[model samples]
Target: MLSSALKAYVNAIDDPYTIYMDTEQNSGFQEELKGSSDFEGIGAVISKKDYYIQIDEIIKGSPAFAAGLMMLDRVVMIGSGLTKGLDVNQAVSQIRGPK
Candidate 1:
């Protein structure tokens, strides 16, 4: 109840990238973001939280950055809502692609 209420407050704030992570998840995420992977997206790093997709970072030179996407932008609708209601995995699959 407490965490849900807190999350609701934060979610109301409009910063999509900020999500509460427990200690273990935070530590693992810390290690993961420091490394490189061949995965591709709109040049933005994102994670799926409870009900929304969170964009963590926009690579400086990536297309997403060029398009003016900023950190903490909740993905509301994508591709004219073609990807709406998709789970995190499905959303990522639709948004990410080969560069």
Candidate 2:
């Protein structure tokens, strides 16, 4: 309701990284930062930028690094679908696991 509106309004502004997280989300984010790569992935740091998820960093020796996915690479598609309208959270979920 109100929270969603506020979040949407804030995210609508110029700051692409501006975001809102609940207690569960905050805790999950912290946990995800500490060795959550047990699952297979390309090993790239992604962030919200320009209405899409952009590669902020590529871990050395990671599959993403091996695949030549460098910093600032715009991820327009995840798997077979386009990322045109997906939010950061949606993109992150899609990016997780073996993909």
Candidate 3:
């Protein structure tokens, strides 16, 4: 399938920051990066840092801020899943959803 082919091509290049996202993934990724007032997820901006997902910013009055998460905090896990091998897109998708 096209998805697999795209993944294979990206993997061939071996760029951690270069990822292929499907339509839905791109939509969610855009929403998360835009800093919209009405947002889902933990209300924190994140990025891939080394082998982990790092929280770059905690939005004011959001669940993440309420939970006392700080900038540069490395997220090792999401629920029961480890974040070690996940790219930024995958991490964002996992983090975004209804409260």
Candidate 4:
């Protein structure tokens, strides 16, 4: 459909910064931009480093901070799933959800 078409167009453009986001992806992107609340996430900023995910920041008073998660802590797994080879967005989808 339109999403596929847009994705194809973006792929054709061969620009690393050009990406087509579907409704859910666009919503997530917008929420991240606004730093909005009411979502179900650990409130820790994470990034992929080498083959592992690392915590970059833990928001004050957030569940992550309450759990004693620290910046630079490596994430080995999420629930039953191993975090190896996961991109940041893949890790985020596993972490974030509707409350």
lDDT of 3 by residue, 1-99 (tens): 997798679758876456666676556546767866675777766766579998766667878899999877899998789999899778877877344
Residue-wise C-alpha lDDT for candidate 4, range 1-99, written one tens digit per residue: 897798678769976445556676566545655677755677666766579988766677878889999877999988899999998788988876434
* Model 4 C-alpha lDDT versus the unseen true structure: 0.74
Give the poorly placed runs of model 2, Cα more than 4 Å off: 1-37, 97-99
Residue-level lDDT of model 1, residues 1-99, one tens digit each, is 876686578768876556665454354445445544654456666666557776776767777889989887778877767444567667766775435
Candidate 4: clashing residue pairs, number: 0
Which ranges in model 1 have alpha carbons more than 4 Å from their true place?
A: 1-39, 82-85, 97-99
Worst 10 residues of 3 by lDDT: 16-25
lDDT (C-alpha) at residue 36 in model 2: 70
| Per-model TM-score versus the true fold | 0.53, 0.58, 0.60, 0.61
Which pairs clash in model 4?
none
What is the number of backbone collisions in each predicted candidate, taken in the order shown?
0, 0, 0, 0
For each candidate, the alpha-carbon lDDT, in order, equals: 0.64, 0.68, 0.74, 0.74
So what's the TM-score on candidate 4? 0.61
Q: Clashes in model 1: which pairs?
A: none
